[model samples]
Target chain A: MSDTPENVAATNAEARNERHRERMVRKKTVMDERIANAQSERGLLLVNTGIGKGKSSSAFGMVARALGHGLKVGVVQFIKGRVSTGEQLFFKRFPEEVRYHVMGEGFTWETQDRQRDIETAGKAWEVAVELLNDPGIALVVLDELNIAFKHGYLDVDQILEDLRNRPLTQHVVVTGRGAPQALIEAADTVSDMSLVKHAFQSGIRAQKGIEF
Target chain B: MSDTPENVAATNAEARNERHRERMVRKKTVMDERIANAQSERGLLLVNTGIGKGKSSSAFGMVARALGHGLKVGVVQFIKGRVSTGEQLFFKRFPEEVRYHVMGEGFTWETQDRQRDIETAGKAWEVAVELLNDPGIALVVLDELNIAFKHGYLDVDQILEDLRNRPLTQHVVVTGRGAPQALIEAADTVSDMSLVKHAFQSGIRAQKGIEF
Candidate 1:
C-alpha cells in the first residue's frame, strides 16, 4: 500500500486525536470527583499587593470579569484618585453596574501633610464600608488601601473587622503594595506581584494607557 | 461666621483642591525630570505566574490595553484551548488586529499520553515563535506556556532564545503557574500571584464569562 505524505499525516493526526480523547475521558472522571467534593461557596476576599506593577491593573481586570457576569461592582481609590486612568473611563461606560469613586489625597509625597492624608483615607474607607454593606454590589475593589494601611493612615484592624462583616455574597479586592501581615492572614486570596524588569528603569516614561 | 455643614464642606473642598494643585505642581517638576532622563524603549518580556487566579486574565487585559493603543496583538493558548473563555470570545471581535490561536490538547492530566502532550506543546511553541518573530505583531501572549514548561513539554532555553531575538518593540507575556527559573530571570516583568483563597475550594463552580 502506497501512502502519500498527506495520507500519512492524516493517519498520524487521527491516532493522536484518539489517544487524546481517551486521556481526557480519564481526566474528566478525576476532575468530576474533585469538583463534587468541593461543596462550600462564599464571597472571596482577594488581595493583590507587592512592589511589582499590575496590582491595581489586575483588580481592574476583575472588575471587567465581574461586569462580564452582569455583576455590579463598587470601586474606591485611595492613593490614585489624582490620575484619570483608562480603566476609569472604560468602567464609566457601565454606570449602572459600576460605582467607581475616585477618592484620595494623592501619593504621600505629594500630600506632604500626614494628617490630611489620614483624614482622606478615613473618608475613602467610609465609602468602602458603604460599598461592602450594600448587597447590591457583587464586588468591591479597595484600590491602594494597602498604601494607606502601610503609611498608618488607615487602621488595619478596623478595616479587617469591617471586611469580615461584609455582605456574605459580596466579594472584595484590596490592591496596593506592602499589605500588612494581619490583612494577609485575614485574606482568603493574596497575590504578591514581583517586579522583575520595569520599563521605567530603562528610562521609558510611563506610557499613557499602559501604566495608568 | 456660622459654618453650616455645606459651608464647612465647601471650604474644606476648596482648601483641599488648592493643596492638591500645589502638591501636583511639585510632583510634576520631579516627574518631568525623571521622564526626561528615561531613554530606553523596547518590547517587554512579562511573565505572570503563581497559584492565584488572574494570571492569564491579566495578560489578556494587557491585550486590551495594547489594543486601545492601536497595537497589533497575537495570543497563543497552550493548555486552555478546549474552553471557550470570555476573553477568547471578546477578543475574537477584533479579528483584524488580534491573531488569537487556541492550540492545545487540553491539560496534561487530560491528555494522559506524555508523548502526545509534548507534541501538542511543541506545536504551540512553534506558533508562539512565529508570533514572536512577526514584526507586525506588537504584543504576543503565550498563555499557559508555564504550564507546558511545568510539565516539561517545552524547552525553556529554546523559548528564551527566541524571545531574546524578538523585535525590539515586540512585547511578550507568558502566563501560568510555576514559571521556570530561567524564564522568570529573562522576563522584564514578573508577577507571582499569591492565592489566599479560591472559589473552587468552596465548591463554587466556575461560572460562564467569569471562569471560562
Candidate 2:
C-alpha cells in the first residue's frame, strides 16, 4: 500500500531534523575545543576606530560594563570638550565609580589652533597617564585619543608606551577614527566600526540623549 | 641677510594659521546651515550588525545614555539566554530604569531543535511587541533579534511591521550579525562593525566583567 501524504510529510521532517542535529553536533565539537583552548585571562587593550558613529558610544558602554562589575573606571575625552554629551551627564551620576574628564577645546577644525590643541592634548595625556598608572582603575577609556595622534597633537610611540606600562590587570579602551597602525598592532582586540548609514545624512538632527 | 631663521619660521607659522582659519570659517558656514536645516526631531531606528564585536555593547551603552536622560528602557535579549553576560548583571542594578528580559534557550546551534527554537522566539517576540507598543519606553534594545530572523525562527516582515507601529517617539536598537537588507533600509542609523582582531584568536579566554 502507498504511504499517506501525512506520513510522507512526517518522514521528510524527521530527515531534515536528523540532518540538522548531525550538523550541530559537529559544530558543537569544534566550538567546545576552541572554548577549552582559551585558558588565559588578563587585562586587554581594545581599540575602536574607523569612520563610524559608535567608537565613543561603545567605549562608554564598556564603562557601563566595567561599572556593573563593581570595577572602578576612568574616562578621558581627548577631543570632545566643547559639548557635554549624554554619556558625560549620565556617568556623572556615578561619581564614586567613574572618574570622568573632558580635555579637548573642540574638534581640530573648530579649534584651528595647533599650539593650543597640543597643549590641551598634553594635559589630557597627563590625566590619562595618571589613570594608566593607577592599579585601582580597572578600565580606562581614552575617548578620541586617536584623533590627537592622527593630527600629530600627540606622539603615538609615547601613547603606546603608556598603554604597555599600564597596570597588568587594567583594561584600556582607545577610540576614534584613523587609529595609527602602531596602536592597532599593540591592541589585543580591535573593532573597526564602518558607517553604513547615518540619520544625519537623511536630515535627521542629532537628538538629545541619543547623540550627544 | 634677507631674513633670520627665527623670522622665517614665524612667518611660515603665521601663514599656515591664516590658511587654517579661513578653511575652518568656510567649513563652519556649511556646517551651521546643515545644523539649521536639521530642526525636526523624532525617534530613530539604529542597527548595529556585522561579524565583529561590540554590537550589543554599543546598544547597552545607549541604554546608559537613555537611563541618564531618565528615560525608561527595555532590553529583550534573544538567542543569548544560556550565559549570564555582564550587561545582564549590571543593568539589573537599575530595576526602576530598565526592563530586562533574556528569552532564548541558548544559541540555535546549541539548541539543535528548530520547533522548540521557533516557540521560544515567538514568546520573545510577544514580549518585544508589548514593549514596542508602550509609549513610556523611550528606548527598546532587541539584542540579537537579527539572528532569529536570519535562522528563519521569526518573520522579518512581522518584525518590521511591529517596529513601524511602535510609538512615534520611541527609539529602537537592533543588534546582531548578518542583519537583513530590509532591516538596514528601514534603519535610520546603521553601523557595520568589522572585526580587525580578537583576543580569543590568540588563546585569551573571554574574561569576566569585560567579555561577558
Candidate 3:
C-alpha cells in the first residue's frame, strides 16, 4: 500500500484536483450579488485623490451597472466642455434613463479668461447640485470637479457639505486628482487610484475609443 | 402692500434666493444612504476590451479600496513584463496583505517561440488559479489577461469555468484590452472603454504616476 506507483500517482492527482476545485469556488464568491449583500445599509462613495488614472472610468462602470438595474443616473462634468465621451455615447443608448451635462470651460489655460472659467464652473455646480437633490437619480458622477476645487473655482466645504446631505437614495461619485482631505473624511467609502503602468509611457499615443 | 419699488425688489430677491437654496438642496442629494449601503457589500468586477486606457487603473482603485478595508489581495499581471508599475511599488508598503506577480514572455513578437509563450502563460496561470481558490484572499485582480486569450495562449473556457466556481467570499477582477464576448457574458459586470480623446494623440508620452 505504501510503495505502489499507481497509488502514488492517483493520490497526487486527487490533491491537484482538490486545489483546482477550491480556486473555482473562490472566484465565484466575488460576484455582484455577494457584493450587494456585503454592502452597507447606506451607500455613499467618494472616489478621489491624485489624478492617477481610471477614476472616472470606475465611476462610469458603476453608472452603467446601476442603469442596467433600471435605475436613473445623472452626470455633470466640471471644467469639461461639451466634448463627447465614450460613456456619454454609450449612455445615449438609454437616453430615457440617463442624463448628462458638461459644465466645462475646457482646460483652465484654454479658457485663459479667469472670470469665464469661474462662471462656467458656477453654472455646472448649479446643475450638479440640482441632480444631487433628486432622489430619483440613483447615481451622479462629477468628473473633474476636483480640479475645480484645487484651483479654487469651487468650494471644498460646500462640496463636502452638500454631499453629506445629499438624498439618502442617491449615490454620488467624484473623480479628479488631489481630492480634499475633508471630502475624504466625510465619504463613507474612498478609493484612491494609484497608477501602476500604462502604454502611453512607452511613447504610444492615446488611441481614440481607448483613451478618451 | 403698496405697489412700491421696494416691494417689487423684495419679491424678486426672495425668488432668486429660493432658486439658489433649491440648487444647494439638489446638489446635496448625491450622497444618499443607498450608495453607502452598497459599499459594505463585497463584489467582483472585470474591466476588459481592446487596446484602451484605464482598465488596470480602474481595477487598482478597487484594490486600494479593498485594502483599506483590511481585505487580502493578490494581483497577477500578464503581458506587462519589463517595467515596475506604481501599483506594485505602492503595494510594497503593505507586504502582509498584498502580493504581485508578473507573468509575461515579454513582447509577443519578441517571443519567437510559440511553445515558450504558451508554457510561460501556463506557469503564471497556475499561480493565478491558486490565488483564485484561496478563500482568505478576498480580492484577486488578473491584469492584462485578455491579451493571453487574444493571443490564444490561454484557454478561455477553462478559465471561465474555474472563475465561475471560485470561493464565495472571494472577489475577482480581470483587466485587459479586448475581452472576449463569452467572458463578458459570463461576467456579472462588463465595461467596454471607448476612447474619444486622449493627450497622447497630441504627441505627449505617458507621465509618471499619472500613466505608470
Candidate 2 regions with alpha-carbon error over 4 angstroms: none
Better of 2 and 3 by DockQ: 2
TM-scores, one per candidate: 0.76, 0.96, 0.51
Q: Listing candidates in order, what is each one's chain A TM-score?
A: 0.88, 0.94, 0.84
Error of 2 at A42 (Å): 2.1
Worst 10 residues of 3 chain B by lDDT: B33-42
Q: Clashes in each model (backbone N, CA, C under 3 Å)?
A: 11, 0, 49
Compared with the true structure, what per-residue lDDT tens digits does model 1 show for residues A41-60? 56778788878777887777
lDDT for each residue of candidate 3 in B1-212, tens digit (9 for 90 to 100): 78699999888867765665555455445333323333333344445453444567666656655654556789887776445665666555567878878788675544445557678889889989999888888878898888789868899999998887788656677887778778876664455544433334433344323345
Per-residue lDDT for A70 in model 2?
85
lDDT of 2 at B36: 84
Instruction: Tell me how candidate 3 scores on lDDT.
Output: 0.65
DockQ of 2: 0.68
